[model samples]
Target chain A: MSQFKYRADTEGMLNTYLDWYKQAEYILSLKPSLPDKFKTSKGAREYHRPQHIIICGLGGSGIAGDLVKDALGNEIKVPIEIVKEYTLPSYAGEETLVIAVSYSGNTEETLSCYVEAVEKNCMIASISSGGYLKKFSEKTGALHIDLMSGYQPRASLPQLLFAILKTLETLKIVSGQPYAEVIQVLRENKTNFSPENEQNKAKELAEKLYRKIPVIYGHSFYKGVAIRLKNEFNENTKIPAKAEVFPELDHNDIVGWEDNELSKNFTAIILRNEEEYMKERIEATIDIMKKYGAEVIELSSRAETVLAKIMDICHLGGLASIYLALLYGRDPALIEPISLLKKRLGEKVGLQKKLLEKLSKTVSQ
Target chain B: MSQFKYRADTEGMLNTYLDWYKQAEYILSLKPSLPDKFKTSKGAREYHRPQHIIICGLGGSGIAGDLVKDALGNEIKVPIEIVKEYTLPSYAGEETLVIAVSYSGNTEETLSCYVEAVEKNCMIASISSGGYLKKFSEKTGALHIDLMSGYQPRASLPQLLFAILKTLETLKIVSGQPYAEVIQVLRENKTNFSPENEQNKAKELAEKLYRKIPVIYGHSFYKGVAIRLKNEFNENTKIPAKAEVFPELDHNDIVGWEDNELSKNFTAIILRNEEEYMKERIEATIDIMKKYGAEVIELSSRAETVLAKIMDICHLGGLASIYLALLYGRDPALIEPISLLKKRLGEKVGLQKKLLEKLSKTVSQ
Candidate 1:
């Protein structure tokens, strides 16, 4: 829409935007392997079967739990609840499995919940590049999955998702290696969205989405993808976007589009898959939104399997968000406000030193 | 901000707007009674203990599940997952409690999920006024809690919430009477927000929220209220609004506010309760939003218990939405577009007759 044009070079002013595209390949190329700490631990084998599972993390790190919940929710025997709060649920006790995920391992909410989980004597695991979570895990002999460093947590989706799936397998809650199939699907499909292709659908969609609020919609399993895309739009494009899961959206949010003024600013991006049971309802909702003057864009998943379809759309959404950031002359990678908040928060509470001391004592034992 | 003024009379042009307020009082006066069908059924007593619970409904009916999940999530022995889709989770089996809620009982999505739950052999229960759901329940001999008719599903929050809580009590998932305290809180606080009260905080907040997008923020237990408030603002005011939970909001959405163009159109309403565990983080999020030029309005909950506080805020939020609707010169009750969609949908699918025929046969048997 603007004067922005597609560039073949990986570095297009913002390295982060380019890195997002490359990360899809990284995710695709990844081998399904668990970290030794998580796989080879006596504690991992000795742990009791939890009646419930609570995954604690926030933002990019936290969203992994959502993906797992949607993707493998029905497959797992126990209930898995995602907690993005500072405190653990009261039921998170000996019978609960607590997975603390933070890319930098310093997320205060995750750390706080981890502490609470430990006090409640819940089985614990940790996933992070490196930070207090790693140190704490080492001290407490908790199963830890060390992710590769130097990427934003949002950019670290592959590692986050892989680790979560691996944890599920290790717990014996789900059988077989599901992550491998997802990787294969990602590998086979990476070329479909390469920037070299002049007709890249993600790029085209991003161009259409320029200068408008993108409302992502999905149903059932795709609900996780909708949320993921909304997060990418916020963090990568720095745009105010929203995600609505269907049937729910059909009820209340569809009416909000009646306001002609606000409707003008939104472009509804509906994620469609043949697997969606309520396709007719989604269509009706799109019709209502379009009739009220909102732009509607439908992106259908091409993958055959449920997991593959989710990954395929997630890759497309990531690329689209990067393209949008480039169009707006934004860095895509820079989140100054979030960094500032984290910094100010650290200064206000200064929990890092206290956590280190606590962990060091545990490590000595 | 507008020429709209508060009036003592319940007839505020829109009967639905007046009805919502009256319904709050009606809820207060409710004796917390479950229908004989739900309480005394041999079928209800014969059901086995479910390892997990899945509540299936959409829109207003679906939100009841969320309220139960938030209020009693910690207390419940098993995990409860709310499904707002046409399909049931794969894990839903004999060991799953499937509570199907649909006010109109003809909601296609709910019916669809009900069918799936039946196929999965999930322990089923139904809550609705009357329609296909009622007929189906009678046919299947499932526990049914029939609600009084003639109100919008969203306006029927009290009945929906109470029936859900009552069902939980009957299942022995929760001990003692939980609804009584909430009803007491609602009765005592109803006068504080009466349309005649010139200094009513909800009305004042609604006035400030006029002609702007409302971004509601709450923490932990208050998250459900934030979502409910957002739904009310959308359906009742016919305006676009957003809800974000604290700690999670701090991680990503607060940065999205930095976009000056998008920030200009939003009024941030932060729901504060004395019991909020992450007060510091919530305050930080508010500061960041305000620093980016978004108008910040804080509404504090006054009730003592968690359930009471949630209900207290929900009641206040309902009044605010109605007030905002009056200000916009929009009728709070008319959902003509939804009705039109439903009519068109029925014509397209010809489902009404088929569902009736199927259920009628079951009812007769």
Candidate 2:
């Protein structure tokens, strides 16, 4: 009977998403981020020796850093900690390396935490552009690598993520060469991954999963993608989703699907990269899931490098979720109620102001 | 105009749940489970040699094996694999040790897999009540440990779980004393954590979260608890909930909280124990969740053994979910669709008849 509040018609909504993609394309156009930007010498010496790496940020920007720690934790000799609070853990000390990330450089939470990291005398690094975070890093002499930010934070995942990984390599936690090559591979293969007909597994998935909740699953190293898919659906399409890993899921969650009634409204998207072949447990798992009414989408990784294959698919999944939102005729940008809730919480607790000196430091056994 | 199909009337439905609990109690009473009911000390002595272990089962039973792997993974020298399907991994060799678990030995998937483990020449052991599983184990000359049944498989979690721990100890992978103490502590502490009123965090959590989705977060060792909580809710109340660990959630999922619409319907419950205090990262991350729209319910472990704490809260959470289902006027006992889905699936894909074989084993470098 009437035009929609956000879009005039179906065609208009599609165009709006196109516009969203165009805005993101400009940011992604920027060159090799992080280590390329920092160009640190191969063996740039010296360190106060950080025992804990505290990452402070939220949403998309924070997740990339969190993922790096998760995948690399078993490999990394030191503990990689992700600090999500405005206040520091009581363990904060001078030995901590606190990396404050904000793609917009204006994210309030990241800025609030940056000040705390400074107060605690922890090593601080900023990943952002033209905001309070950028200004604070410049004024305070903290290591600030300007993030190319024209797109939404969710879209600018690679640039922000690259900085965190490069920082880790700079710190001698792991090598960055393979990870850096991943970014190039991801960019090199975008057009092939588009939602053009049935060729796009990401888009085909979005179509098949039009109305159902997604129960995404992945394995050890690439767990980040599953987390990414769940939130992308939640934030972009306003659809519900959750993810779990294996062979751990086999132990308990398999029994859950038995004698349950939720089979109709859910789908399991198993992220099956080249490495999926490594897990014998997964075949049994996939077989078990097939027994349920659940539809399993076998997702394969692309590109030559693991990093490239991971990012390309994860980002495509992000776009697929946005398209799903368009299909549902919902606004992808507005999150007003959550903002209101945060405002209410802020007044009631004064939580941010109360914990201004927060930093997290790691201790030895 | 008529009435809700399954859930009819709220108060009357609760009577049904109480009746199910009563039935479960009667089942437990009549069975009087013994850990050593079908144990063969000679068989156990013969079955322990191996370079690696694969624990096979589903749901609560599967998770117990996984929990041991997660908690003691670094502490134990050999890697443990958890299998949920009706087959084994391709890497099974003469050195492989397999533990087959099925609370009800009639459980189809485990039986399918148990048969395969036999063909693969895996040193095998069985954990179940009298059923096809025990019969198969006897015929196949495999070691077997019979557990008391009648409580829902989800309810008899401790029996399936702890027996595996004891089995592992008998294999010389661990000291048997810690687990025995854990069981003793659990037996002594079940009084306060049982149903109805006064200091029952699970009951309180359920009442508060009657119409909300529970997002349970846990630490490394206790992530299994969060998994258990989600499964318990599924099998007991037929509700959909999700779980993730701390540092992991901080990465990407925090963005899902940025929803204006979904936030109203979602509630996050965090699972914490001693790890919360030791892992400052978890504490900081939980603080961030508090800032967001998350309704935090911190469940602390009673100062006993890990087994006691897990069993105590899990039983309480199970009761609460069933009660909540009753409060919503839903039938807690009917898992019709899930059962039907399995039947339909068995017929649809020629999966049941497919030759179950071993898949490639992951060689973690």
Candidate 3:
């Protein structure tokens, strides 16, 4: 394996990628303890199984919910909903298990949802580094897991995801932790994706994606992975990207590629699956895209478990995005637009206060 | 209002928009009848209230599930999930209400979902324009609504959406139909969006969006509307368009706009809302985008109810996409890529047969 070098990784995002397995390992090593109220007289956990699960957070922190759902598709008995907004669904009540995740624990939207979940009497567990969420959890007796800080929320996905899975395991909502397998797979694959590896798939994908808008496609199983790749491209590559799922895109988005001029500007990256039917549909879709003058790249993972497969794709996509940013001569860690938005939003105070007031009105009703 | 003209709408899509209210009226005029097995001896419909609802469809038909969920956010008692794939969620069982919708009736994915729903014993209802889905419904005793034929599935959205709403009302899952108010709102606003009206907002939007990638942003309430608009731009305008929900985009997507040269190639269309907090967030987001060199257009609805507001946006977006197609000298109804895909898929004989065989294996397990 040849060692690859990165030019514009000012914040060591590549190094962070190399150490992701350690984050997962650290999170998995910690035992998630159930609250006393959730335990029975025999010192065994006893409670009504939640009818559904709602994971609330935004941006980097919020994505864990989607990854978890994609990793455990149809395996968990209950349906999982990811909330990216400030309000909880009307049906979220006592029977709902609400997991609030925020890397900084200060995201206003997640905080709003945390309040609503509490008001609705939903069973709650929260993961955060340190912020108002941890303070609130301490006062309210909600289950809280402390996260190690200092990393960007987007870079801390492993910690956030493993924490949620561990909590779910402790609650008996999901059986068997796949953390070990996921860590092992990612660790083994890291060398192949490393910057020093001249023939790394991530570098090849980044080269093809240079100066082109990427339209990432994934199936039902890897939908979250596709979205995460799009987000990574947007944030890391500093270019617009699109993500759409298969069968869904076949219904409408396929037509968008008919214009030769417009279609040539996009490169479609398909996250391929092994299922025979899905494979056939993807093959047909690729032929159609190619006929319209669009470039296509197909990526498949060799990871053993579902969680491992998802993480493997994500890991490769993350490295590719950073390389793409370097090719564009940009600092991968820079996100001045978000900082400006935050500054402007901070100038207009009382947004959260108003949100809380509205929540209170709903609660009263 | 000054009269505007369309040059390339060969299929009369504008006329269909003009007659959308009639489609709603027609669907509402028919009283949906519940299956006898779902009724009680008290002469009233009685059955276990579904713990959740799943709508299965693709393309034009599948969009109804999203629009309904958007229109009735937090208003419906049960959570609604839209399935765009060949299989149902493993958790979908007797207590889950499955409404399978396929405008063409023979949509492969919907048919597959229907078969799975049957094997899982989900409460099933279907809507189609006379295809295998209808035949299956009749043979299996599932309720089926027949849609008027001859229009493109995308052009027949109102019929499909209203039929689903009517069926839900008949099942006592949703109360007090908003069909009348929605029709009234669309009719009252139709002239303002017609091509003949020079002051039409849709035409103006199309003019602004010409030759630019459209990045549409909607809040939680209008997320479906944003997606529908993106789909319209894809199928009708034959251009790449993107949609992201607000608050969520503020987290990651906002970072993608930092490159001045790249940001100038796109336009942002924000579907504005009335909520105070959402309004503030949109304003902050707009400022950030403008600072990054992207053009921004903000649209707000004056309709009173949620469903009406949703329809109003859809109507405007539909008209705008058509005008955009005309601007590009292309027919709005032409979707040759999708046709080619379908043809290729058809050539792969026994794809559906293989899907069924796999599904049966899972069932037998």
Candidate 4:
């Protein structure tokens, strides 16, 4: 029953926009309740012997693969490579396991990768709400997990991410239900950041980020979280923000801070969690940011495990982005420009198909 | 005789400031005349077969691995993974080839990766001008390639990229000298963008990007080129520019442009080559950018091969950064902020070492 202040005209335009906050609760509930059907699915068994696993997805759906790559990279027996492009790596073949993830089941890049994997004799699995990917997966007898419909792909991170982890467990590549504890932690920690509480960390962070562009920094361990946060700020807040990994940013971006005019417009957020070797380097980078006149905010992780830390900050980032959108007196769910771009792209595809058909007809005549 | 118009105070401070322009020519001439000793170095012969190649580096040095990963990704038999972290992937082992590249031979991440590789029993090779990496490689009997000293790592793309390719050749992973033709093309095309010529495309482009943040877009084939250009602009021009690959940008960034205030301040440059599948998507994205009131400049590659195209645009981007700096009456070589940051980091490291030594002494007593 709690709502933040916003313009009357903009406030109620998107009725279900606030449901994004429910995703963490939904995901945590699914940890114990994720059907046995999905865990022990035939697709997991079919791809169990793969020498390498290739997860093909794009944008929001694609980022789940990145989270897996960062969180369970060293822990996984086989390499889990995220292919954001249309083509699979050359090493992808009979022994490769390809998971096509498209929340809408219509992402072109994921579809192209799926077709390429099929051509290369790779075992295929799919995760989608319901679209071309699901249809194709079912037709080909590949394992397919249907995500809950009606949510944006970015908002369904928990479901998409769990699907990947559960698949890994089923294949015996990783041991135990690794995400179960993290889910419980998220469920317990959810109420601490409710919008009604002025002490909410996410709202406080969002207040600091208003009217400024964010330059997020993180070490390699949680670089994916930074990336996810950057994406959320861009799509959810409709703000231009960028994320750069540490040590890498030091080599080049430090020079840009010399121009106070540009530096002052940026809010640098440093995300740290159990970073060992690069901890001192990150501290130095923060000192340089502050000295350069840019506002610096450091978010340190207090979670017991790396996965917990990653998920925690990621949850906080999602909340911050949404809160920032509300604070700016803008509707959080209206992505008019993205819809326009996609519509135009669809039209172009339609024209291309028509032209190809006409050319083929002329040839036939 | 070919001097740019700059304020008197900014002029003549660094005589060799424009040597970056001569890099392509230098790189080309070195192709045929490269020392036979370097061509058949002891390191090249020591580890001829690796099940997979892991390139460990950061920033400028790290980007070479990306170039190789993109350029020769499909051609190579084994996977070429770029590690910009302190730890190696779990799959890395005795059969893994770890190429640690630190231009100054002291990049902390590369050194950490080198140490981690040694611990994991992975075959290691070191590339640097000189530092701890060289000394360690020598002591451990690993292959070490001492680079020509006294140049920023960012300006040594030709040498770094070629070293990776030559190593690939030595391992029989790729056939024919792939870089020789690209070098020739670069040398022949260098004069078209001479600083003295007012008709220089680089200078013209730099003028358009003078007061605006550049949002660079490129397909998967040329994403590395876009990244290199972003680095050049950030370091040489001291401007904050962002680079996002096509298909990926279409996913989220299109929404950020809805804010006309922010959109009008950005200049979107699309870097294109022989893109097949995503060409329509990119064109549509450009249309969306234009509709959003942002200036869109399409930079099409004119070179014959992929490598040549990459080098050509990268060359142009470097020139544009320098030209923009000169136009702004600023010194291109003044990296005072980066130097200050490095000094701070060094102090931190020294203090840590002293503390550890003191702690050990106390324990021994």
Candidate 5:
């Protein structure tokens, strides 16, 4: 068996993160109790205008934004573009909305895009804890939300998610208050990371997944959590992981599990939320998965807000996966192959430049 | 490449598909009669009954269904589920709709789930050329579409896409035919795909993409074709490839292009149609990508139904990628790693099955 190397002391990682999460908690706690006046985006003047949104960040910070836009894109009317490079979109004019999200405002891509956004006269908003993004927000007349800064970006996902959702609300795209219940749930979370039966479901779930490739399942809000779980396994444990949402998996992928062989190296963790409609379906999916020969773990959220619940779940998955990573003796931070390719890509220049030029001609014609 | 071999003839690959384009002239050669009116589904009653959809199938057959769902998912009211495994959802019941799609109709997982769908009394349909699925449909009085056979499933994407869209329309989710103008334009293609122009665009495209990754991009209907292109590159070219769609890519991934030395290894192929409203924005994006030195290709349809245009583009990409594979000496048909994994997965008691039993207990509770 390969050794999955985790941090020598869990306390170290946890301590570092606790300080950051506290910052996020502090920001949320300061909101004065005002009468809730919700805005209907469909009725907003901005709805009729041509606006573009440019998101700047990379890796975990970037992927989260990507998934959100991908999952909710059909609903979003204005074009939302994620900028992974230093340059901004050409049409990122005054009407463009620039969202600079960086857990550590020092992120090169976000900072660079920040400069571009400023120059372009785009509407700007920022999410981070005291970094270039924050400084830029202060320098310019931009809305800046300073989140708690200690946890890993993956752990601080809820803070990031809610922050973005709130921004989108300001843009009048969707209602944000409906998510308050999720936030409330996550805030109530207590760190019972025991893995002792019900008290430590994350730990117990990890143990259950010891000899298997983990496939996380969830419906509704937990779908993101499932993805976070997969990334946790990928980044922390360095193990193969996959996540799929409910009712949808029933279609084609379900057939892939008919053979008992798929289970030889597989375990499934099903996240159960209080959703009345999805609850029954998750139950049914669990049965169908088990009938085909697999291990399943059922876990419910115990956080104070939707973001908090997601964070807590992510923390649980991360801790467990980190342990799994340590067990395999793999370095948690080294994603060398991806980095190498990025390097190789930087070197090749001649062919790509021409392609882009030609593509422009085709589009213009 | 570890001495990989191509499945079809080398020379025939490039021009043969282009010749197939000439067969479009054969369309001009035809005695114009009643425009071929293929089946248009009219039954939403059986489908959309459940809050979600589960699609099951494999390879080209499975992926084609996925593309349809991916394209229409955002516009859809209920979630569309796609499962590539051998089981049914535990939650799937009389209210659930299960569509078993198999080009050849003999896939093992599809067969198993086909039986499960019957037992569960789920609304079911079959899209197959011939095999157990067709047989089962006949036996069980299920709606079945016997697609045209003989062509490679990848080549016959048009049939599969049309069938699924027709199914979705019957289900009343998308609820529109606004695609008529776009489809008509692409089918009646007048673009230069011939072996002539100073830049034989298609041939030059085939030659240039010979050694690098093809990162296909698109906005709407071409989204599926982009996926098909990647799969063709992977399954046919045996190369690592990716596909990105707009709106979402703008959120997070766009930022990764910053400082990416590896951007050169990727050639961005933008699949656009006349329907792209944000052409200016995409052009700006293309400029930023080129400035960073990434290859970009912009392609439009031949003016037909989206199915027609999609198939035409896919056919072109398919031929180009296959020839590229031959140049690299990679076998196109061997999915040995996946085959081995399936063998292993079939041998074990899958964890999903165990969860199924536990879920049964929960539902009974």
Candidate 6:
């Protein structure tokens, strides 16, 4: 790890990546029990199985819902809708289970949705570190899982995601996710992704991506992984990156690669899954991209389980994004544009203060 | 229209754009009734209102699901889930209203999903021009809406979209979407987007996006429209374009715009909605992007109704992409890469042939 200058890792993001398995291990070990409120709630006591589940949050925290949906959409008995906005779906009511996730517990969108969830009389559970969401959850007696503070919400994915899975498990909505196996897979694969490994795939992929835009491709099964990688590239590499799923991209995006001159500016990262039903289509798409002069790199997971496969690809992409940032002489930890936007939003609209007040007033009433 | 080179418009795409109102009006005028199958189906007669609705399709055909979800997601009583994959959700059973859309009736993914819908005993309805989906629908007594053929699936959005809206309307799932008013808005605004109109905002936007990668931003409400514009740019303009929703992008994507040198090669198109809850954040985001030296173009719809607003922006974007294609001397109608991919897939896997045969055998059985 010391072989590469760590100047840009202001928050030791690499260390966090290296210890992701540990974070997952610790979170799973905690084995947080379902809140008594959920068990005693009228909706739960009535035992009318939720018609659908709505996971409401945005950005880093909201991604948990996407991951869960991608991993369990086929297996989950009820539909799961992710809300990355300020309001819950109009149909979300007593039969809807709304899980509000916010790392800071202060995300205005999540806070707003929490207020709505309360008003709709939807069965609600929440996960947050400590902020208005945590306060509201405590005040309203909704199920709340407390996360550890001091990490960026994006970096806190393992904690947030596992908490969501655990909550769903507690509700008996899903079971046997192979959390331990996924962590073990990450634990074994970490060394290959480490900077000190001379043949690190992450380093090689980052070299291929340096100074070029990345277009990450995944199939339906790994759609969330594709999005997670794109977000990682955006926040970590500080470069424009795009993600499009297969079959869908085969329909429209393949045409975008026709212009060799413009296509050369992109590096296509195909998150290869051996089990994808449209494997042949993905291969064809890759051939077309390469023929058009875009650099193509294929990344595949060795893990057998869906969760493990998702995390394995995500870990590799996450490291590659950091390496690309280092190659560009950028501080991977810095997100100045986001901060600037937040500052401007605060100064102009006082959105945070207003949302907090609104949540407090609404929940109290 | 004759003033611009028609070499790229071999399929009369521009003419289709001009006559969108007519296409929509004709579809609406048909007043396609619910098929007797749905009227007498166990799920429908029981009046145990569908627990959820699933729209399954891909690419040009599948985007109808997205548009419907975006336009009516809030007002619809049941949660509408758009499945862009080969399989329906495990929970999609008799209580789920499955609307399978495929313009050519031959999209493999849609065929696969239609088969699953049949097996799952889902109350199924389908929209397609003519293909395996139509064949299966006819033989199986599923409600089927026929669209006129020849237009590319992407170009057939108006016909496909209206049919889906009409299906939902006939089912009493959603009502009184200002369809006539939306057509009126498109009819009134089409000329301003026409090539002969020198004051065309679409032309101006195309010029601004001429050589730059387009990054489209929309809030929760117009997320589908943003995706439509991105796809239009990819398919029509033959350039890599990206779309991310607000609040979500503000979390991670904003960090990617910090490098002015790389950022200058990109143009940001903000799909502005005055009714957006986080308007201040979007404005702040634009400020930050401009500060980082990225050119920003804000496109807003003047129509009062949600449906009208959505169509207005989509119409403008559809034209701008074609104009951008003409600027690059590329044929907007020639999706060579997609054709190449399909050819390769056919040679290697014969996906379409297999799906058609499978659907035929399954429906017959």
Best by DockQ: 6
What docking grade applies to model 6? medium
TM-scores across all candidates?
0.88, 0.58, 0.93, 0.87, 0.51, 0.94
Q: Put down candidate 3 lDDT per residue, B162-273, tens digits, no spaces.
A: 8988888888877875667888877876778765677778889888887788889988769988898989988988888889998899888888788666666688999887
Q: What is candidate 5's CA lDDT for residue A261? A: 35
Model 1 per-residue lDDT at B197: 72
DockQ per candidate: 0.56, 0.12, 0.68, 0.57, 0.05, 0.74
Candidate 1 structure quality by residue, lDDT tens digits, B1-365: 68554342233423343344355445345444333432111233246668888888888899878877877757886778888876776667767888899999998877876666655556778889999888777666677777878878887887787777766666666776465667666665566666677888768878888888887887767888888988998887888778888778777787777787866777888888643336666676667777777788888766667777777787788778888887877777766557767876787786645655654443343
lDDT of 6 by residue, A1-365 (tens): 21245687888898788778877876787665555553222232222468889999888888878988887757878878899888888888888999999999878888878877776778888898898888777666767888888888888888888889988887777886888778887787678877778889888888888778888988866888889988998898888888999778988888888877667778888888744457777777777787888788888888888888888888888888888888877778888898887777666665566665665565555
True contacts kept of 5: 0.00
| Candidate 6 clashes between residue pairs 3 or more apart in a chain or in different chains | none
Clashes of 5: 125
lDDT of 5 by residue, A199-252 (tens): 654455656666566778766557667766766665555444556655445432
- Comparing 2 with 4 on DockQ, the higher-scoring candidate is 4
| Interface CA root-mean-square deviation for model 3 | 1.4
> Candidate 4's residue-wise lDDT over A209-327, tens digit each?
88778878877668888888888888888888888887688888767777676566678888975444477777777777777777888897667777777778877888788778877
Per-residue lDDT of A190 in model 2? 53
Residue A290 lDDT, candidate 6, scale 0-100: 77
lDDT of 1 at A117: 69
Provide the RMSD of all predictions against the true structure, rounded to 1 decimal.
Answer: 4.1, 10.1, 4.4, 6.1, 12.6, 2.9
Report the C-alpha displacement of residue B107, candidate 6, in angstroms: 0.6
DockQ for candidate 2, C-alpha atoms: 0.12
Rate residue A295 of model 3 by lDDT: 90
TM-score of chain B of each: 0.87, 0.78, 0.92, 0.85, 0.68, 0.93
Error of model 5, residue A103, in angstroms? 11
Model 2 per-residue lDDT tens digits across residues A244-284: 76544544455445423544556788877533223444665
Off by over 4 Å in 5: A1-155, A160-365, B1-54, B69-96, B106-120, B148-152, B166-202, B259-264, B273-277, B302-305, B339-365
Ranking by lDDT: 3, 6, 1, 4, 2, 5
